[model samples]
Target: MTVELTTLAAIVAMAAATVLTRLSGLLLLRYVNFSPRSRRALDAIPPAVLMAVVAPTALATGPAESAACLVTALAAFRFPMLAAVALGVATVALLRFLGL
Candidate 1:
């Protein structure tokens, strides 16, 4: 069906994107010389990209989302990424339960 085909196409596109990003350093090194400043910039790119992607959604959604974001950032200070994410999830759930 068309829907199934569309889903398959989306999955394929996502996979291609994942592969491209993962291999990007090797691909770029072949054609480009990375200076120290450029290397530092490249190292910062992923977090900047992540913040750019997450900020709008986290800020615009609602109080619960904002609270979860804050909780995650705070937890991240003392815990690992996975634990911080779990704390965020728990925070959203608790806030929703309390009718926030």
Candidate 2:
């Protein structure tokens, strides 16, 4: 089925709105000053954001996935970031291979 003009326009508008919403923070960064406290907070943001994104997925997937993520996170904490990521990916792959 073909999409109507109004529906297409609505989709375009929604896409633009989503893009702008995501970019708003970066755009505002140009006007803002980074203080020491803000810098520290920014450093913490990546781990917090990563946990937020990963936790739900792990929980939804089950214990095996959660264990994989934990192993990966711990490795990342103790070694090179790339190695940690690789550990996590490898754990997931191994788990899948084992039919877990």
In candidate 1, the residue pairs with backbone N, CA or C atoms under 3 Å apart (3 or more residues apart, or in different chains) clash, namely none
- The best candidate by TM-score is 2
What residue runs in model 2 are displaced by over 4 Å at the alpha carbon?
75-86, 98-100
Residue-level lDDT for 85 in candidate 1: 76
TM-score of the candidate numbered 1? 0.53
Give the per-residue Cα lDDT of candidate 2 at 15.
Answer: 100
For model 2, residues 1-100, the per-residue Cα lDDT tens digits are 9989999999999999999988997899899999999887886665666666677877788766988889876774567666777888889889888888
Per-model lDDT: 0.78, 0.79
